[model samples]
Target: MMTDTDITSPVMDGMGPHGTKVGLLRVLGPAHVWALGVGIVLVGEYMGWNFAVGKGGAYAALIACWFAGILYTCVAMIDSEVTSTVAAAGGQYTQAKHIVGPLMAFNVGLYLVFAYTMLEAANAITAGYLFSVVATMTGHTGDLDQRPFIILVIMFLAWLNYRGVLATLTFNLVITAIAFVAILVLFLSTSGILGGGLMEHAALFEGHELPYGWIGVLAAMHFGLWYYLGIEGTTQAAEEVRSPARALPFGTLAGIMTLLIAATLTWYICSGVLPWEYLGDGVNGSVAPLFDTARLSGSNGLVWLLGFGTLFATLASANGCINDASRAWFAMGRDKYLPGWFGAVHPKYRTPYRSIVFLVPIALIFALGAPLDQVITFSILSGLLEYTFMPLNIIMFRKKWPLNSIKRGYEHPFHPLPALTLLTLCGITFFAVFLGYGTQLVAMIGFYIVVSLWFHFWRYRFVNRGTQFTMPWPKPQGY
Candidate 1:
């Protein structure tokens, strides 16, 4: 239905031929991108991941984590290549637009918006819950609802994002450092409890390791994915990076490697000290698992420190998600995929103020209304759906635009192998989610149907009628 002219036409409102109309400043470097990548999902290192222990026990969960880690590594490699080549704000949405089509790009953009905003909501709620826990520990909690506190946290972070990316990322770097230090402290303190060796603890895991067997391991894949879930979001800031070609790969790789080590230590040490059942039980599914591990050292000071550290970690994740999601929405709006107002950049701050404002209320509603598990399930499904299409994007991009023509700052090793590997892992994970979480899958389907209808009836007909979906960067001359 669409042609090459329709795909490459520049219908961006208020934009010049050189593609600098949106008013986003390039202020981020490799270090800032790395911090944003790590900060966006740092809470996973402290909490939420322990829920996998319930599905597969400690050992099974650990194995599932290993598999998920490999999936992310492959995805990161391919993404870095694409990000360097494209250097766009919307990340995968931009890739989908160029390689696939506008419809597919629309879907990917919506999926990412849902994923990041829902994640932000989840992190905000988790921060509120952690604050309540600390308050309780101090014997000052009567009836902490947490919804109001969550809203307050969201507003605060949104204000920070509205200020500027520099202040936002600098805050991210500081909190991320503190959060990593807290995680290291917990890992070190719990080492003695686990007899100082993961293998030694595994040897004694007859009752601990494979309680639920292969089925449990299969079910835990989703939770295991939580560890490195949002690292790819770093590419969302490509337009704001000083040199995306260099920064995208370095920042994303650094973030993923850091998460890998943290995930290994957190899972092994926490599982060794506490029963897997205890770690992943009840409504919140052990919201403060790392803090619980810290309790093994019998240090009240350490417990309180970790608890506050968990709060800050959640704040950082929520903040980064807001930053990434707003940019995606702004990119879509700039391309006329949504309302024109969403495309507007703040004259003073030069940030996507409209999109940031739009997302806050939605995040607040989700944070207050949805259960923690459901929120996380929805977020994971959205993320997996976005990831599923990425390899295809890479393949199609290469088919259309040969490597010899375009300049690439970084290239993935083995070419298509990494992309193929990512596809296989994504397929397996989707199958697992379908088999394990049927209700959630149905809910996701229902949500998709609603979004599809809105796009068809409203967005397509009203918003994007004559708009041309073009890449922000230049193409090869022959093409």
Candidate 2:
């Protein structure tokens, strides 16, 4: 009598030999949840976020940080409530499918996969670059080939994920913590708490006004996502967590809280040490901004420490990206938006082994030869596209299934406030992205349109419309 909606059924992830049930391990707790989210995003603080500085100077980047922080705060709150109830592998894709419908879900799925995979590629490439920096520090390199390190990092982390979720995220937790502390170490040393004299806050800001006006702050907001790009990836753990209700809300909110602290501290520390002219160089912002700041600290120990922190942050990011992207892919496959072949979980490891392995080359494609700026823009645009849908997703979710309709793990207060805040921020961010990278923004929209057509005409047939509504709740309010 087991039905497709029966989450505990043996066939939920499809059957294996001897009729063994295979699915993701539901063993993760809140700390692992924090690690999965913070691990992916801490890399932004270490590097990519300074691009905002490049766009708007240090002051403008700070404005962008505050704005982006508000944007993701809305994301964390809204996503926490939805994912807590849905409790599925796909995160927002699952929420969209169960609440809004499959068309939106399909697009969201693609967004998640592409966003995280590209991020994974970026992290791997950065790892290779950091490795080269280490080599130069050791006095042994004209230039070391980065391809081997990039390939090695991807292959190794994908292998780690293929084995099991428990080990994968547990490893993420350790490195992510060390990396965050490294930032704190740098901050304390530079604040003169540890007897340093590198701060030039008033001196640097005296004449270095924002290169552009408020429009420049808008431009910074676009790149500001680097501060908190992948925290929503925490929700991808819904199906895998020990307690979706407790863990999803707690871990996600906690992760955002941590990011707010980390982002503010990172901006404060770096802005104090480095001038607006160098941190956000008009041509190419410092790739290793924190490390650059560290080297300026007059402490070689801090330099090596930040170096190790950078490497660990990238590794953790690539690892978390692999986890989130594969989950979205696997969830889509489970509902037949993708081939069911990807839906299979490893019989022993209880991980989405097939989906994890399949995405290796997709990530490698961008990591190997793509322009770094384009890769990052592509990733950020993908994430922004996903955020644009959140207001709709939350609005529909509440309308269809009111609070009293069923139990919820967590409920964010001020129904339309968070949703409205999310919508406004999404609008501002879209304009900001369009202002600077208008071509890429339009190109990404077109790319989604092309795939969306493919999904509408061909992929829709494979999706079982009736059966895909798997949330184990009473009938929806209107239905």
Candidate 3:
């Protein structure tokens, strides 16, 4: 008889009907795991992004994040189920392969590559921007543009992740501490605004009156949508954690809830002090909205803390992105979709060493050259795609096949409806971003989707031809 904790046990890593071992490790805990998920939601930059969405945008953000949280909270629950069922390393792509088909899985694999890789770059570049923000606030703003600093930040982050998870967790703890303090300082100095006074004095939209239209709502959502981008990422680490059946869903929901509280408070506070009109300038506006808010609010010390916190936050998120992205790459490589090099795990670290190395240069170029708006756009594209597909997989699995046989601790209160609602909302959000940003961005994204599909059929299909990719279909179809 095999023991439960045995690494090779079918109960732990699980086995296909054909008895192939899908090696996976269970190595994470609740606090650290929850921290990773929540951290992405409370990014310090939202203070500015929320403010620009006009006066009403704050309320809209609150509703949006709250509802989005509820929707993705379900997504997390469903993802936890999939995590436990497959217990394999590939995560979303694994489920995509099972539910949709191999070709579709290959497409998801490609999309995950695009999404996470760009996310890594976005984190690094945002860190660099925060660096300049802090420097400027402390009167140290230099002549250099942010690209070089972004490159350096990306390199450092890659090194930290390359070291190991323990080191990465330690770094996360420190950065989270720093971010908490920055938030505390902002609360203290701007406490006056916290007691609903800002709401009491919130001026009507007088400056450059664009008439609060759908454009304003979409712009706000585009920026605010960043808050909820990586909601399911923590669940990807469920296998790496203890009692994931309990911990994964709890951590996922708890993480989003915590960030919702923290982020809402921070956004409201910042708006209370600086107001939205002043936050949107032409030149300086695009760059340092939070720093400017602190200055205008006469809370320079608090502003400095936020600046440093943002730098740290950006780096931490960047590191997490590298970890997730590289793993995704490794997973795909193992499936023989990408080049064989990506599957080569590091001997010492036991991580995706080759994938990380490959990602670094791509990250550097993306970090150093791409503008923030473009980065944000790419992030939106990747994020929304993942968000849409993730929930769809859950619904399809639950309805088509009825995987109720799987043991899942936590579940969304509403079943198929919540998932459907989330998918619809995501579609609407994507359309809104496309309209607000204009056709050029849409065309570029469209071109990317087209090319990615072509690559999947023409390139990856040929590569994985001999390997029979099995998907669990409905009884009428075939499992």
Candidate 4:
């Protein structure tokens, strides 16, 4: 009974309240809105070591924010343009298929899967870390190991996403709000103790050595990408957005800008309260940096509260990544770049059951590979590569062959300038990751590029051939 149009409609069947209603109108408001972008960046802050390394001896939190603003702005613009054109579920893969080519699109899709899967794994590992912190503070251990903890978290996240977008967003809002409060409390406590109050010393106006050269600035920009990694998550929800053309772009840009400012403020206040020396591997490397700060500030009660808050933040970030990655797979599967199973929606839940099942093992492997900072750095580096390609896709689409058939909703303010700036920053990020992480990172990246290239040429055969194995593109929508 399902018509061809129904299969590809903006509001597909499944994934609604009671599994009956269409679920495309789950417009994310400001609360759940900020969570998507901000939560991603906050992870680096919660895991303080990365911030310390990137921030160096200089207190450049504010300047870092300024630079983050620029980088995120470009990412937002490029994501918006693409999401508007193909507002269905296929996210990056869908856009790249249209602009770049089916094979390149497939590669990007796979990269996203790997990136987000690792993100989820990282979160699950952090969850165990948070639980351990709470246990250590409360003086109780309930037989919880990291591996079991990871499995439980993944299952819970899968259930949450399966419930519906509205439920997921609502939960996201609550957790994100708590996380925000935790951040504020962290800043205040850190400032109250240090010689200079949070505002005076933490402002990061002084002591930064500006990279005198372009390469230096770019090098600095490399470590900073983690501060703005999740700016494009909003695009994954394009199907549910009120106006894909307008809302997707606006929401994405707004989210990135907001996160940039918040991260700057957090770094400033945190650095001011506690010197980098006090934060060691346990606190900096663990999930509850704020709790460590609370303990150092000599407030036991606040430390407990911060423990709860940090747990919430880590869970939120992990949940968001899991949800986003599954959707990306669903989109690609729907396009026939991936297996048909991934494309199939659960008849009742309206969620991508096939993709979720496929994603679980990958996430598990990533979680095991985790437990090290270098692993996280590598995962984040790959993500930067994805971000870099986004702007390139926009330029390619415009110059090589325009997607004029698609209606435009939101366009970038500065045309190619923003895209060009984004392109340059991404190059900086690539080199910085290379320098900071070294040869292993390079080998990893080389592997990714080679794999991506292989799949495109051999697997899909450029989608235009209308292969029966691939997901058939719906008849072009009537203009």
Candidate 5:
């Protein structure tokens, strides 16, 4: 255990010798923090969230959006508090290792790596398809295989991560801002502000707005996850932020606000213009709902704008996913949860260069190997598992540390209430996922179970106990 002499701050002072040899560069600010979280989640507004429209109806999708908005509010609150305190690369994984236990930490870290990696794959595939969709929309489509597009996108984004975090996330910030403005512009255009309104709500929702009913809304909650899946990823930047206390809470809170607004506006604009059947009619709903809505407006300018938004949003999402996934993998490796070799940071770039390179092919394989909707489902399921652990992590955090044991950057109010709300929402969303993708859900759980067994039997034996609890905090109440 660390003494007061061991650590004067929350940064991992007890990282042992491995971290001393190399370390992540601390050069990020609140803007980068916002970029990392918003860049990863804004793609949902462009394409993925419409899958919920397919499961329920337009109305059901809207309800699910509000429901998920609440759930993720809790996510933001809890994560902001914990991340402010931990200030580590592993985010919740690091939090779990310190407050929960080794096994739970292992699973949480896997959840981070797999969830973001799968999201990265989905983003690559979507970016590829965005080009093809626009080609056909413009009357110039013969047969765009999208394979090369997917491969190139993945390789380019991985290269960005390989270079440096600042360059990678700076690119994300620019593109993410553009994509967000496109949504805002679309909403304003349709709100009777640009000479005349374009949306015909009466025409779009004529007796078919809620065809599937309440149960459908319940089922729709699964895809509702798309609206805010990676917003919690803001926490992953805790380790690198110039000031974790200020940056984590402020950036994450700002990010969630941005998403909530974008989600509401996207839904209102799309529901007003597009038919429910058209928006939700596919394996995973409309691939480019914003672009399609732009097409319906009969404005070539808006079409080009939203189309670019779709493409840029996907690239940004993939870029942020690589950033977050590599950090999680690198953190696990630093403590021998996976392999010690991956823990090494690049001496020149000071990034987790090894882990970043290793995840590239894994991203490509999942991108090429699965259908877009299936890949998204995989990402969401893995994301859900980590969220189910959130309330527990926070509860244990409060009990173990109580208040005032250490200097916290931020503290969430109505603590147990947020915890209970998060747990209940996660339960409801899990049921929603089960209703739609029961087989995949079961298979995912089974996969985790198998990995858990492996970790217990084999991987746990190699974990360096001294390196795991590297957080510089006083001993817990019970311990």
Candidate 6:
């Protein structure tokens, strides 16, 4: 096996066989990373998350979401510290390789790949569904199938990702801005601040607060998780960042704070304007909660705007997912964890063209085959497993490399407390998933086991023959 020094050597700066240099352009700044972080997750503000109301009613869902927000905040803080310190691609996967081991790193990488691609598929599906909704609302539709639209969306994003990171992220900023404005409009309208007169119906429970009681709140945890699920994608851009030590932390923290504000306003306004039961009903569950809310408020203009806005948000999210997932795949390939072809960057665009090309078909398959709820469940489960290791990674980082030795742009307060808290919350979230969807949990475990075994038996030998897995820490003197 290659030693840490071998892996961290300057000579192996992603030089593939035949002396090909596989790398990305460092054209992104803090603002771009921030836009990516928000863009990747803005869809949740428009849809998906409100499905929690279906499980626990409005009040119970709100409580669950609030708790989930806290957990995500702790996670974001810890992740920022790691991102600033390590400043590498692949986010949690890179962090885990240095702090844990290669095996854990492979697992995390695979999990992230699954989570992000599935999220992209989910967003594509949502986009198609929203388009159908818009068509019907506009009184022009006959036998509309969303599957073709989903495929088109996947193809479009794949093409965008292959073009270049600068162009992709520039577009991301514009769409993300539009998405934010869309949410702001919804908040103002539903809050009666826009003279919508919808706040008069703002009742908390109205006899439908907790249909499944506290147990329902547990069930809602996964749905609530949707609100902040993709915020961590910011760290995946470390390799492409202009100054990762400063940009990663600032971008990630800014993204988290913005999502928190948006989540709160979205939940409060949507629940207030519409009956909790109506919002929680199965038919409208995850399909178009926001659109339905605007429709109920007697605003055709608002509904039209939100429908288009939801499409923009979902497309932006799908685009961001491709960007993040391609980087993780690229990182793994560059390190020889998988085939080297996956690590290849476009000569002209400086993006992971191969990985982006690879994921397009997979996303299309997922969009066509799986139900939206199942897609969400699997995505959340995979994400939670990846998240469970982050706190432990933090503790290990501090132990292996003292903080004083590293140049950190940001650090979490209270030392290990945030890590511990995040760990506990992760456990709770995992248990909630198990309690609610036992079969899905079993399937997720089986998937992880299979992937782990494949790595150990087949891929490990190949990767070990050529490359050494190492952390991105500065070498000590005389090493």
- Overall lDDT per candidate, in order of appearance: 0.80, 0.87, 0.60, 0.63, 0.88, 0.80
- lDDT by residue (1-479, candidate 2, tens digit) is 21123333334322321133555778999999999999999999998888898888889999999989999999999998888777778989988888888889999999999999999999998999888878888897587999999999999999999999999999999999999999999988988888856777888888767788778898899889999999999989887877778888999999999999999999998899887867876235578888888888878999989999999999999999999999999988888899988888898999999999999999999999897778888999999989889989989888888887776778899988988988898889898888889999988899999999999999899877677876666766687
lDDT of 4 by residue, 233-313 (tens): 776776665555566666676677667655765666555554443432333442344565566666676777677777777
In candidate 4, where is summed lDDT lowest over 10 consecutive residues? 1-10
Cα lDDT tens digits, model 1, 1-479, are 11121111233212443244556777888989988999988888788888778777888778878999999998888899888776777888878877777778888888889899999999988888876876787798497888778989999999999989989998999999899888887776656653453224654466666787687788888788898889989988887777777889999999889989988888877777666678877354566788877776687877877887788789889999999999889888877778766888888898989899999999998999988888888899999988888888888777777676566778788878878888898877877687668888888869888887777677876554333544433452345
Q: Which candidate gets the maximum TM-score versus the true structure?
A: 5
What total of clashing residue pairs does each candidate reach?
A: 0, 0, 2, 5, 0, 0
On TM-score, the stronger of 1 and 4 is: 1
Query: Is 2 or 5 the stronger prediction by TM-score?
Result: 5
| Comparing 4 and 6 on lDDT, the stronger one | 6
In terms of TM-score, how similar is model 4 to the real structure?
0.82
Q: What is the C-alpha RMSD of each candidate to the true structure, in Å?
A: 4.2, 2.9, 4.3, 5.7, 2.2, 3.5
Among residues 3 or more apart in sequence or in different chains, the pairs in candidate 2 whose N, CA or C atoms overlap within 3 Å are none
Q: What 10-residue stretch in candidate 1 is worst by lDDT?
A: 1-10
**What's the distance in Å from true for residue 194, model 2?**
2.6
TM-score of 1: 0.91
* Superposition-based RMSD of candidate 6 using all C-alpha atoms, in angstroms: 3.5
Candidate 1 residue-wise lDDT at 260: 91
lDDT tens string, model 6, 1-479? 21232222333333333255756777888889988999988888788877788877787678877888888888889999887766667888878876677889999998888889999999998888877876786797696888888888899889989999988998999989888888888878777687745764435566665788898888788678888898988988877877777888899899999998988888877787767766766354436667777777777878877877788889889999999888889888877788978878799988889999998888888899998878888889888988888888888877766666665668888879888888888887877787778899998899889989999888887675423544444643233
Q: Which model is ahead, 5 or 6, in terms of lDDT?
A: 5
Off by over 4 Å in 5: 1-17, 137-141, 282-285
Say which prediction, candidate 4 or candidate 5, comes out ahead on lDDT.
5
TM-score of each: 0.91, 0.95, 0.84, 0.82, 0.96, 0.93
